[model samples]
Target: MKAPEGADLCFPLLLNNSCRKPVPPQSDGMLVLLSFISLLTAALNLLVIISISHFRQLHSPTNLLILSLALSDLLVGLLLMPVEILSTETCWFLGDLMCALYYVVDFIITSSSVGNMVLISIDRYLAICDPLRYNTTVTLDKTKICVCLCWMYSVLYNSLILMDFLRHPDSHNSCYGECVVVLNHITGSVDFVFTFISPITVIIVLYLRIFMVAVSQAQIMRSHIAAVTQQSSVRVTAKKSEMKAARTLGVVVVVFLICFCPYYSPSLMGEVIEDSSSSSTFVVWLLYFNSCLNPVIYAFFYPWFRKSIKLIVTLKILQPGSCDAKIL
Candidate 1:
């Protein structure tokens, strides 16, 4: 696999003329496993989204936002992951046109996931801090607007990649014929800002505010309950519920950081170390892990989801030969 001719000097060292080689066979098994996991996770999340949408009881604004997020993850896992796995395995079997489409879909889904986290954080903050105004402030219309703005902003941010690709198609250094959006240092810096830095800043700030609100609400609720209820069991139960909610949110935040840090850290480091292969196969897999993490995290931290799964399983057992299936 020869590097493309007359590529720009700004291309990463890995894409330089001397670095091109046959696809490594060492990681084929890992790629296949990751691809399979991504496919299964995507399927499960899609089922959850569909089940929640079909049931009117799960129609709250928070669940609606979660369903949207699950859809985005599903798109990433279903459309992008297989292509990525193929590229890693066989050195970009897809042609240029398909690669470009993959790039666009990847950008949209990744951006939407980050955007959803920010929106969810804001929702949690309002629900805890401004409970009196949450219903009015986060109405259906407002939620729609917020979701639209997130998608629009993501589209705009990623449009620059298309523009750059169109302007310098010859400069693409990847053997797969994929558009190398961040070819040079300047473009790489811009990509980091748009994809990593900005989103991380927004997510961190929003979660901080959310955590404060949750803590304050828990304190106030405890005080009110203590004054009204003389029963020790009632106070303990209320405290336990509040603690469980806090733990769930904490798990969400931690999973976000763990899954995203590897990718973003390399982007930041690339600014200083121009010739690093730090963002290689391992880092790519770490980024891909994020799409699979959310549903598992939700199941681990939320009792409702667990209960729903158990009910579905029991129903399936009772209806032994029935083809009817449902996800909860």
Candidate 2:
């Protein structure tokens, strides 16, 4: 059970002064899976980015939220996920400055992703519960401004959380190979309420209201189909479309909560949850794995996403005038 004398030292040259390198069982196998998931997340979110950006018809306000979500997930897959995977198997070879910067980038992307989800729930809530006003209220320009503000808010908020570490990156490190920045209980509590509690509460409540309205409308549509006028039929079709979009996005949100809840469990337990801890590695990866699963959820539920993937895979998107091609 003992690591042979110096086998546990991250820097054997430093002998007693070096931090012990953790030798987790089956770490090689885990690394391989993590690598694959990181690559998959990047590739899948890339498809989403290209699909929404290239298709003119897909440029709705709702799709803009999705585009924003995809951008955050793409950053996770491309940058944060890979770095976390490496950190799990080895010491932080990248300097303390990079370590502090890495966490800042991770927090900003994650908070923005959560913000996009909250925005999406609000979008669906309006579309389903107030269909008549949805278009006017959720205009493209307004949605664009909201998306910018979401990222801006995330950057500002997380910067405050990491301000001490940014100013003194090596303050918490006991040795050269370790990277850690601990927050006080007050900061931790503040982060939990804002990042985990408030946004999640809003998302769940809005979705609940949307769900009730959608069900009631669906029953009404079914019962009155034979006597429905042309105008009534058009309204019914729009309602169905809105309900479908809500349902699809609901799946994405549910999966997000499932993956995220575990990651925050330590916070809920009043424990100091450091990202560099071996105990938190599984939950952290589970959280990052959500990025890979988001695109899969879209492929299963949205026919347009499936079709877009086909066009992209076949290189049909390369032809002139492809942007005008009807995807929906």
Candidate 3:
């Protein structure tokens, strides 16, 4: 139970090769809270997935992007969050291969989430800035293609970024019980640029343009031009719906950036980057916390999502024609 300094050892028989059991970063109450977070995140994202996937009206191009994002967040909750919680209070006894596999999956899911956000921004951009061609440009099939490309690119890119480490999984580990992945400065910086700065720049720019166009359109619509005829009124109503969708998804993007910035701040300050350690405990969980917040955002902003939740909760979603039942 105890090592030479009265500290806990993960593998007592292994002596020098064993890792010291990490000091708990949080109290027992905090661990319980973390457990609650893990469950809530998985549950919320699952509902989002079901809500969008099942409801026929919710299966638009924008919602497809949302579905992609929810899938990535669900993986974060189901796989990464629980492991992170355990690793904080204990050792990674999941073995070196599993460790390597875990980080590989982590990077893939994270990169895909960024890719999904970028796609969402572009979808909103077309909807607001170029409404004339928006329907033709952002079709369900095209959105599905883009989502597939995003995930495929993430897998390929992260595999290349982690190629050396993947081949020699234990090279960075100083002990038997810890799962450590250290990216050289060059690799970390490249990843920071591609995954963080580049995608974030695109998201912010697209949303800013969307905001400007939305405001101008709202002004025009309010100036009585929108009420001139029945057709104009219908068009104005359609544009308003698009604007509302943009606003809701914009909140999702802003929250994502707030959570992700801290995790990548080390690179901004020109420091070494490491994954899965106590030092990064807070930032990592903060990033994971974003997963649960998304569906909460949807619940507040999108009535369809709220209604779907009620149906799912009441088990009415199990009945026939439930998916066809009007949600929007």
Best by TM-score: 3
Q: Which residue window of length 10 is worst by lDDT in model 2?
A: 1-10
Predictions: Cα RMSD each: 6.0, 3.9, 3.9
lDDT of 2 by residue, 47-120 (tens): 99999999999999988998898899999999988887777778777788898998899889988988988898
Which lDDT tens digits does candidate 1 get at residues 155-245?
8777675566545543454443333434356666676676767776776776676666666666766777775656576567667766776
Judge candidate 2 at residue 284 and give its lDDT: 81
lDDT for 322 (candidate 3): 90
Assess every candidate by TM-score: 0.77, 0.88, 0.89
Candidate 3 lDDT, 290-313, residue by residue in tens: 877866764446788889989999
TM-score of 2: 0.88
Give candidate 3 regions above 4 Å deviation: 1-6, 224-253, 298-300
Candidate lDDT scores, in order, read 0.63, 0.81, 0.84
Error of 1 at 208 (Å): 2.8
Give the Å shift of residue 216 in candidate 1. Answer: 2.8
lDDT of 1 at 258: 79
For model 2, the stretches where C-alpha displacement exceeds 4 angstroms are 1-8, 24-27, 222-253, 277-279, 298-300
